[model samples]
Target: MPCGAQAQIIGYDQPDAEGGEGAAQAEPYKPSKRAGRGKGSRRLVVQPYIEVNQVVTAELSPGDDVLTYTEVAAGIDAGISGQRNAVSASVRYERRIGWSDRASDGDAISGIVRGYATVVPGVTIEAGGLATQVNVENGGSALAGGLFDGDSRTNVYSIYGGPSVATRAGDVNINANYRAGFTKVEHSDAFVATPGGAASDVFDKSVVQVADVEAGVAPYDVLPVGLAVAGSFYQEDISNLDQRVRDMQARAMVTVPVSRTVQAVGAIGYEDVEISSRDALRDADGDPVVGSNGRFVTDKSAPRQIAYDVDGLIWDVAVMWRPSRRTSLSAHVGRRYGTTSYGGTLAYAPNDRSQFSVSVYDNVAGFGGHLNRLIDELPDDFEAVRDPITGDLRGCVSSLEGSNCLAGALGSVRSATFRAPGIAASYSRRIGLMNAGIGAGYDRRKFIAAEGTILASANGVIDENYWLAAYISGALGRDAGWSANAYANWLSSSDPLVGDVSGYGVTAAYYRLLTQRLRATAAVGIDGATRDDPAINDIWTASALVGLRYNF
Candidate 1:
């Protein structure tokens, strides 16, 4: 399951390959003739640029209006690669000036960074951050594609950091890791659709922390079978309704070698999982009190009521196989959280130019904790994909390790905690001078709320989301290039009033190097959203942009 550190430790027979004996013996090191010219050499690249563009947007439904604006932006892209550290980051700030009185002027900042560094012989530090904009539907869904021109847009910020220790004491290997994260959503309180409609409790902010430690010996090293012990702790504190979720577990594992390249593992453990929250304040008429920001007011004197509490024995069986260097698989079936749970990961790389991967996960967390975990799993070295007009980070990143996508996590922003089980797959390949990739996923969230509370209506509610995204880019020539991307999303909820929602968008861009320090770009895109409810109006818009950038 994706909820606890146990999921990360199961179905694996080898110690972490980063600083293990197997890794050190896999490759032979040769001394270089020139000093500071091999792996010790450092490489750095930094590019600062200024940009200017003109954007035009035309409304296609519910109204006939045209909006125009001039945008000025500045940004920097930097990367560093060495034996001890590897990092990459991009940041941009833009300000728009409208040409007409009815047009609204605004500014935005967006960026992404992920990296890791080796502080000592067997210790490493890793960190990442993300800042972006997203469109929020009045009902519940949040879309991260295309650009919107009104107050429906909001900013999201998240950051995480941790340290990992891996070392060997004689024959036993010790591994430990700890991570802390924080996430916040700005302007999320504008989710109230109508005066008398159902109130939407959007997420506010949260703090998440996770720690894991294990000691084990590989099979055939100390005995006929491998033996290990592990323990983990996970906690999340959500500001909305003062909610909290905590999980702690300890287990003993045994691994038996099935073949030269396969292993069977089994584990039994004790786990305690709890979820609790406070109720909202009430008025004289017993009606829930609403704050000025359109959210429920938390009663200071209210007690924290338990929504879920389960403690018992947990057991799991798993298999790990590595037939060759290009193929690997890990799968497990277990009983956790008082239910049957299962998850797995599969990765195949036929060659240096093509790769495929799939992952299935089961997790329980709030909006902030889920988002923080997604960021934490991103690759250490990657190129951030961004929307051309909005400058917001796209849901995916391109990397040599494997393409990481977040479409499954960005489906909803409701304040209630949920149990999420989802599956995602991605394929990427390099063809000549072109690169192409696609990702698709399905996610289901079952909300959990305390009975007899003001949020009782949300208890046991289920929401399902499906999404697809793809992109193709190549070089037009030595000094020119072109790219295109498209995405689609569909949402279904058990709530009748909320009904179903669907959204889609497509964008294409062309760029040419005009000079050694200057470049020109042009892009066009269209976006649309619709809901099954008749009272809500469908939205459609078309936009175009022309820009010039100078690198310094």
Candidate 2:
């Protein structure tokens, strides 16, 4: 099965996996406006505590292949502090012993077992997670997750279970959510990735994508003008691309009851994109190629893709004014007029905390995205997964239609929209009885990119670029017991189709409550980040952790 490669099995007759084929589901990856590794609040006390850490650094990390002595659970106490929401879960796995993508070499196993539901005041729900990832004989380049080689390496089977529903309707607040899932890839043969970039092609069946979702919403009382509606969807089917997606959003507000405090807000959305196919082809070493039957095109194989039929629709609108209680004014407009995308964001708030804002965006009118070079070199190495018959770079003319692509950097992104302006503020009081808060923000952006190397008959690489960022956060103590928190962030980019990155880090933590079910805790942090975007990239990293707990 590894002597020359040849096995085809890619399915998707409308079985979407956010790969496209709409109805709903495709938006629930919002865990990172902050949270790469943040352990800000802690509480535990009832008995038993043991947690440890040591991952001094990683010079070249290509998206977590961890466990070089990753030191696990170590132990656990109970829970209580920061208002005890006691629940626990653990389960893990992995294994990759060589060329795990130019050498991250790995075999990985994920772990999570859950049970936590004690943050009571009125309404609270607890949910846990479980996962499993494998790479036993990985030679890398399964077309970077489009999967063409799913056995003897790269087998990620996952199971996510859940239960979450917070309550409060009288005061205006409600919540509900659900997640269901499955991912399987087994190939005794069949892999493809080579159109000029010799070597690196394997596919023996894969293309089933689905990540589930269910939702409910309610929130309204004014303040910033609140009222929201929700819907979600997701799917997965490696290589052959059995995709799925679905989305829904809603909003409304009013306080300008003729200046009764000055408030007016609005929101609107509609999304539908579909793509289904189970007659897949891209057997390469065996030549099944086919995508619209033009003799194979679309970055030329191994998930480079070129099969479209995901209906599209997107829209947005906004307005706000609070002419002084302290001071306030806002304006925002957004739209994807089906690929004519527009943009907006502007703000000012004088009190009730503090505020300032300015922004412009239009992620490629139609959200046009057909990326490669491993998602623009995600951390490094993978000219379409190596050896593609000698580093093909997607059947080049130097991509971007060859000629070294770079199409005048798409005129530095003039109309595709992507502008930036920002300002933000936050404040909280209770210095003596303890309980404080502080925040800051800054933004700047201008970009429209699409360089090359995914085979457009070669030619056309280096689209457009420009970017910038800044951030900060703080916390104090005493809402009932103890507290402390801190944060920092910075980012950069000025073209090269967006490259150049920045980094900053800081964190602190502590909490206590020893009775009513016992609660006690402790924490510490020092994080890191740095990105140059592209070309001769540079890297610097850091990490640290500590733990102790017990409660309820």
Candidate-wise lDDT, in order: 0.74, 0.27
Per-prediction CA RMSD (Å)? 4.7, 24.2
lDDT of 2 at 263: 35
Enumerate residue pairs that collide in model 1: none
Measured against the true structure, the TM-scores of the candidates, in listed sequence, are: 0.92, 0.23
The lDDT of model 2 is 0.27
- The parts of candidate 1 lying over 4 Å away from their true place are 1-43, 188-198
Worst 10 residues of 1 by lDDT: 26-35
Candidate no. 1 TM-score: 0.92
